[model samples]
Target: MLIGKIENWTKERNYAHPVIRRAIDFLDETDFSLLEDGKYPIWGDDMYARIMTIDAKPRAEQSAEKHERFLDIHYLLNGEETIGWQSLACGAEPVRPYEEEQDYALYGALSEESLQAMKPGMYMVLLPDDIHRPGLSETGASVIRKVVVKVDKELL
Candidate 1:
């Protein structure tokens, strides 16, 4: 998870995957001036999770990916979004990989077990082991800022 101050982000990445570590560095150094106006999608990969900006809104139903690992770098620049996540240990099993998206795996069923409320300047990191259901509302839509950086598992 990307908690604490920005200065420590680099140090924290030393232990994270190499791809993720480099992605984090890239995100940290980039200027978020464009976000001041509204939410924007920075980068995304169809193979993995769909990386994009989710304006303040209620959490939506998501088919959590399984097997393959994931790297979710959620950066909140404006409002807040309550991100839901569950573990395979407590959630449902994963389905076989589909050719449509090899980076993602289908899940059986799931229940909410963990929640992370993120706001401006706040961010979180989710690994493939983490089944996150993002874009939930806590107090309704409120101008939210965000950025998603997609990373490949091979690099991690």
Candidate 2:
């Protein structure tokens, strides 16, 4: 998993995939405040983004999910949240098997997990091997407006 401020995207773009760079460029140019909550297609099914405003929950109420077919680029537009992450190689038992239609599998808690607080202008990139539990709050439930860009693995 990778985490950074969106303001540094210009320099970070050099190390990112071309498609991811395009996604970052699109994000930099768009006004998320004007976008309604919904899925917006960028490059057909290969890449797309979802704008959502939801309430944060406790970590215990969230599940660790990993995707095999796409990388998740989570960018916060408003509010804040604490995301939990653990490496897939840690051998955490899967509570739910992978659902191809959804492209994710839910895993039980890992012995070691890290948490990061994300606020507006911040982003987190979760690869297929990054088991992540998002939407958690450090304090309590709060509303968060964010965009999640789904980049197909083929683009990597």
Q: What is the C-alpha RMSD of each candidate to the true structure, in Å?
A: 4.7, 0.9
Model 2 agreement with the true structure over 1-156: per-residue lDDT tens digits: 889888998878899878878887778888987889999999999999999999999988888899999999999999988899999898887899999999999986778889999989998989999999989898988999999999998987
lDDT of 1 by residue, 4-123 (tens): 345578667677666666666766776776334433333345222233455555554445554354466666655667777787567466655534445566653466557777656666
Clashing residue pairs, candidate 1? 58-137, 59-135, 59-136, 59-137, 70-128, 77-145, 78-145, 79-144
Model 1's TM-score against the true structure: 0.68
> In model 1, how large is the Cα lDDT of residue 4?
39
**TM-scores, in order shown?**
0.68, 0.96
- Error (Å) of candidate 2 at residue 10 is 1.6
Total clashes for model 1: 8
The alpha-carbon deviation from the true structure for residue 113 of candidate 1, after best TM-score superposition, in angstroms, is 1.8
